[model samples]
Target: MYTKKSTLALILTACLLALLLVAGCAQNNPAGNEAGRPEKQGAVTVTDFIGRQVAVPDNVERIGCLYAFSGHVVAMLGRGGDIVAVVEGLKRDVIMGELCPGIGEALVPASSGAVNVEELLNARPDLVFIRSETAANEGEKAKLEKTGIPYLVVDYRNMKEQMYIVEMIGQAVGEKERALKYNEYYQRCIDRVQERVQNIPLDERVRIYHSINEATRTDARDTLPADWTQVVGAINVSVNEELKFLEDKYFAGLEQILLWDPEVIIVNEAGVADYIMTNTQWSSLSAVKNNKVYQMPIGISRWGHPGSLETPLAILWTAKTLYPDLFSDIDLVAETKYFYREIFNYPISDQLVAQVLSGKGMRAPKGKAN
Candidate 1:
């Protein structure tokens, strides 16, 4: 019994037994498998826009909107009270403050560049909504999974994608009926604009130059800016196939714009409208000469962005601007009031409408308040 070989074997056997016992205990534990991860309970699986199967809670009471755009969609669904966290910048946005007042009180600032893991976890949200691209970040995804909080991804790059995003968000937040109602309303607005503008002859359509930021920067055809022009039955003068894939602003020379000589100029950047109006080089342009240069409306989001909730109103307003004679029967003031009331449940004051139309709360055109 005291042999060296026999003693070594007994020690080995005892160590093996200990390891087996530990393994058995871990397997028996319900908290997780052998890896010690938490178990998901009462989770409903949903396929996101990019086809990722996400396990969301059946009842989502507290929500974190990781993107400002998501906040807009959630507000439209009448679920601003459920939002627990949002980007810091949105809290200070005048348009957001006006549209969803409760967001100011309910949301903690999570992050601007990426999801702040600690801040998000402390918020203790039942679910988080983010853009599809944001979810693709491996580090962020891993962190979110470790916290056991579900995240849903939606895309709003185009009109079809926007509808899909709204529908998906509705399902995630238990606002399916409300989402359907809003979609129906959105479709009708699109139809109304399309029916009137679809038949206008190509040569008869207004030629539009949409300034993206600076006077020389513009959007090309097939972009959101181009889509806005098309929706309003106008021709985008900056139709460059080479710039079609570039999402950011494309640079052009003053001479190029002078050559195009657009009939209307819609400025998305602040103060650029006034700059074009007064610039000596741009004085001879038809848009400038005729006082057809107007600033794009900015409220909860820029009307130029494709997926904005106010896009319908933008289409209506732009159509009115481009073809004042044809759209004479439509009253912009009354429609703006109705849209704000019906969608956001906030009755817009006349002063606020002017501010939004004048792009008062937006970034690019600084220092000039309406």
Candidate 2:
């Protein structure tokens, strides 16, 4: 039975069988990730605004959240207890009181060293998260790295960028699944907004004048450039003309704004109402004469949080304010309640819900808090 040809065929058959067995094991174990597959089993990697690749953690332990809304996103990931800090817990005492209740007793430092960076160092956080693009500058990046910490930044300058940031945040915090859920919800809001604002014919869409007052009346940059202007279906009321007012500065004056002469005026929760109602120059604008003025809600009015779940709500509300008839069927209050419940997992009482949505006692500008 020891024929040379027969022995060669036997060895070939054994090799083929071994190869199939190895393939079976690989399929079952998924030992290596292929391209387009999320690494570490559903853990996706994202490139942050500053251009760095980072893995989105599934179990964020100790976290340093730079903004209140980013903390809310972490809560969505089922890890609020992990967030050890926030940026001043929102300057408006009333909203913070309702939101965190007794929690503000916990110190919120403006900088990493405010209470002492030692606490953060000792905590050995699995990750640290911050909102707003400014946090990701070279200085801060170097600081984080030197301290053996990982940091990512969110840029909410535009609606699309804002949504991307939220998804990125979700993934980074080990809430990829939850992040996906939020994305679906955010897209739904966009769809609803489109349906509502579509009634305004392209050419007929009203022009808007958007501003933020921070102890002084001013023009908000991204309000006109990105979210309200450049969003896919949004129409711009003003163009970015070369002006001294539009730089990195967050606030500007009525004179410059009047020159823009938007058909509609969107006031951020700064000292805008007082200035517009008082300043004769502002009153002269067509928006004031025609009652086409609307107030942008508090929280990220000065600067939106690109990735947090709340950003889309702000957009949807703005779109509704702009086009009520088209969005008549959508109930913002109910939707907001659902949003808070699902994202924060804290059942916000009807009274609190009313307060969050109401414009009563809104904080006048004392400098840009967002």
Candidate 3:
């Protein structure tokens, strides 16, 4: 019923709309998200330790990250909005939602050791990321293979290795150029830390006892290389000469720690430091006698892979605490702020930074965690 003029006008409008749609499609390349970097397509073909060829994805819509640390890396790589599930729930669940509000779902399993195969299968992740050190166990590997999910095991990032993992993961997920930029920037942090510590002799270096929830009442002897000790330059007291039982990888005795007698004791509970400082039995140890014991910040305290990123701060603090005269230039607070803003893309104010690095643990800003 349209007039001839109305019909001709409608046809012209439809042609213009088609051209606009084509233009938008042409411009639609997946650029970087709000997190660290985007995953990139790379020339290198990587085969995981498990013998599976790394499968490249066209679009990674869903991801099942297997460790809290891996989850943190995923969050960092700009997938903060799309992670379908994380291992053992959200990595630092208290901080997860608040830290990255865009993510809508978190499917955590009842247990943490093994990747809950059933839950992951249901989540239908297009890709899976597990820190090789934490998640490359036989059971988990078998489950991933049987389920036909492509997974990669990333190494724990220290000052030096952080760039490698960032780029490697970025490439795997299709964010190549951004990962390289991130890699270079991270390398600078490593170089700066190394420059500060390289001059200190091994003997003069602070003997750090990175404690993992060891108390008199609790029968726990969490050892070194397992804790933040995984980071390069972190002295592994658990594997040192005194703790013969640590060699067994099964059981140990208190005599091991007492014998090693580190220069500093890092405690899971801040109270442990207070007790060690005040305890009658602790008077003999070099760390306690000299008042060298201290508390750990977030990732370093956790001694897990996600916490691996905190190695820089841990090193800075240990150096200052151990040889303040030598490490006068090192500033842990500024370094922490840099990592939050530059690497993780979290905008932490100076006040929030103070709360995060306080000797005591602080909850997220929300009274009831979102």
Candidate 4:
């Protein structure tokens, strides 16, 4: 078989073997790993909040934030620069806008729910983050899948889930270590607050009514406010089953609120506190009579809202508000500055610190204002 055809076949076989070896090496170790060249990374699998396993790219440099909390968590993890696309309202958030100035220039969809796939594809995000509600929509889900882009569903109903969701974002973005560190501080804040307030007896606890936008609209049972109120040893007056208009509804009539006669009224909106204080109908309330109405502080988001990442600070503030003597040493101004600096690595301005502590200049509604 020592012929020219046999000689040609052997040479072709050797060339094919060499090519196969080069291809295998490329798969294991991608090109451009030299000193002057760009480095390509590997893949990592992380389970999202909704229990979906996604293979996320390592060192993800481009992110699309469809969920409201995703951008905040990313910023907290010191990856704000990676955000390439965002949902509406990030630019309007006061703290978020400051923390990540690029948010103002990012590609935003028409709305959180109705994302234009063609527009998003143009942004070239490595991963798209959305809430479970959005992911549940078959149309949106299908559109994302067809594009061959990975997405993570980040949704949480309670405080425990909130912490987990943040960590999950960290995992997706290759910042698991930082996420755990943040959660440690979050837990410590909870432990410190609970240790001081847990001893308060049922009758001794401050009775509170958390007003949302309108005076009558308050927190329902099994909501974020309901949990935090209990955490700070304050009794929420609007947690009654009858007061709930529907499942998870938060509508309490004026008559019902009057019947409860809460000791403290915390309003989330800007001018509602003054309105409740000046209104003749609310004059009979114990909170108004004692002049103990306080506005909830606005930070990265409305601290009292379920969607916010500032719940730890909210708990501390509420505890101090209810019992001044217990948290007398906690200078909220100092704490606010420290929190932003330590967690988000931003040295907060003194003026903004004062504004946040006073809860003033927060005229717009949550998610609609800066």
Candidate 5:
């Protein structure tokens, strides 16, 4: 019993048994790790548009949209019901209100570049989304960072960025597949327009004047409207490098607009087309004289705006409007219905479709004084 070789063999057997027992315990463990200890689990890191790597919960439920654009994106991702806090405009948007009911009850804890930390915390959002402008503000960034909650900054100045933002949001919110589907559709739309208008000479392209909410407020060189108008095979009269005298970099004087003498004028807001057509001040413009003034359609959001997810529809609509013969086979109404049905998962009625296409009764009603 005291023999040295026998004792050494007995020790080796005990060590082998111990190793086997540990492995069996590990196999039974759900983590299936060698240590037999539960693995730490919680968050998944996602990179924002601004390059901030934020650790978002793997399963996000309560979302805080500090920017209206992200709110719309979240809604489009089919997570609209999960939004707990929103920027002011989301509650006020008519289409958003209709599409995402109970959005009105969401808390408005931020405005512009300002965040009320206490209120935002009170909402208990699992994640937050803000525009890059807000993140650029040092004070706002500091406040958001101090909250100890994950936040993602979203920004897009061009069409490419716009598509990327959708993907980023989709990933953050567990809707990557849905986001890929939307981006695919967006690319197809772009390709369709390019294929249709490839042969049209630059000189033959229509000269268009696009007025934003106000009649004088127009897009500039680096804006989305400027980018999309060119893509649609039209000249944006307001994007000239020579016109460096833009007031606030957006407003153009009546004299400047008249100088452009645009062939077609499209206003983004409701009732502006009528004003441009009737006003004596604008009566001498070529578009006004030719009865070519029109209003941009208002869908879930105003299609002409930079923040809109429906920019593809805007591009298609504008291209068709300018070159009807080229896009004559495209049924915009059918496309509109499809967009709502597939993307929003909401079926829009013929009446609502008529209202959106006509650009009437789309604006949110103003609130009364408290």
Candidate 6:
């Protein structure tokens, strides 16, 4: 301890021993080991349509759509490749099959009403998309939670919410840019129609009766079909005391329809239009007498579905159908092609457009056209 050189060497040895002790503590102590390990990345939390917070993986690769509308929106965002599973109805849909044929091979069938936990797990989806109505079920929510796969509730009850749903899905799928592009195009199409029709006086507006199916079920004032009628400056004839509070669609008898005496009848199914045109009882209605009954277009999804992105096209088509002289500048064929090309990135042939408008591409039942 007296010599300088010996003191220096002793100090160096002590420092080495201190270093070894610290390293040993780090290796042996569970707490210290955990502190040294890298932190896991945090999840990205988003508020769903129902205002519920959903914690999703930072990177969502695989997705399962429990609702066909959700699947349709995802496909429109150019992320159809990310879909790992879909409901059997969506997978079997003729328009969907034609639009996203690549998805056919990877579709893991799931039910819209019930969770197929085994099939869902097999699909290896990182997230699932469910309609808000479906997510409200306590049993289904608990079942989905049990799987440990995050799900987001999306509702397309109207156009504003529909746009929001598309944007939300785009963000979830890491395709926000594409979603914005779609919204922009959607707004432009809607604006074009409104700019032309907004000035029409209420009394001058055409009266429209939209039948949901052959059962004579029709849209209420707040439903999508009613929205279409209003957007195009037309009046929904079904908005009476009996149907005003129906919330969605309700069945109407021929007698009730005769009271409305709509000028134009828009049916979701071609067979319904065929029925109306040929039925003697319906001939008294101005729409039937004048042969103004037309079927709504069915594409990848029904245009009448709640919060359908096809609302713009529906508005334009219905407007033209009701007032051909006024909307004559709108070339339906050209507009249909442009819309498919711009929004879906799929070019439509004249034949396909005809099929979509005619209810052929929708795979209507053998005797009934949807």
lDDT of 3 at 222: 40
Best by lDDT: 5
Tens digit of per-residue lDDT, candidate 5, span 136-252: 889888888897778999888788888888998999899989998888888888889989887899889999998888888888887677888888899899886355445334778
lDDT of 4: 0.81
Candidate 5, residue 330: the lDDT equals 83
Global lDDT scores for all candidate models = 0.73, 0.58, 0.58, 0.81, 0.83, 0.75
Question: TM-score, each model?
Answer: 0.78, 0.71, 0.71, 0.83, 0.86, 0.82
Off by over 4 Å in 3: 1-45, 49-51, 89-93, 102-104, 131-142, 156-163, 177-182, 215-236, 242-252, 299-307, 363-370
Off by over 4 Å in 6: 1-43, 105-109, 244-249, 364-370
Which tens-of-lDDT digit does each residue in 13-45 have in candidate 1? Answer: 999999999977764453342242223676667
Q: Write the per-residue lDDT of candidate 3 for residues 182-264, one digit (tens) a residue.
A: 66655564565566666666775555565544533211234223433432244556543433234223333456667768766
* Candidate with the larger lDDT of 3 and 4: 4
lDDT tens per residue, model 2, 158-182:
6566557667777787666777777
Q: Write the per-residue lDDT of candidate 6 for residues 200-259, one digit (tens) a residue.
A: 888999998887755377776555566666788888877653752243447677798999
Q: Residue 90, candidate 6: how far off, in angstroms? A: 0.8
Candidate 2: pairs in clash: 56-172, 57-174, 58-174, 162-306, 165-307, 166-307, 208-237, 218-252, 271-365
Candidate 4: tens digits of C-alpha lDDT, residues 288-315: 9999999988877777777778888888
RMSD of each: 7.9, 16.3, 12.8, 10.4, 14.4, 13.9
Which window of ten consecutive residues has the lowest lDDT sum in model 1? 361-370
Best candidate, TM-score: 5
Query: Which segments of model 1 are wrong by more than 4 Å?
Result: 1-45, 105-113, 220-222, 244-253, 361-370
Model 2 scores worst on lDDT over the 10 consecutive residues at 299-308
Residue-pair clash count for candidate 2: 9
lDDT minimum window of 10 residues, candidate 5: 31-40
> Who is ahead in lDDT, 2 or 4?
4
Q: Report model 1's TM-score to 2 decimal places.
A: 0.78
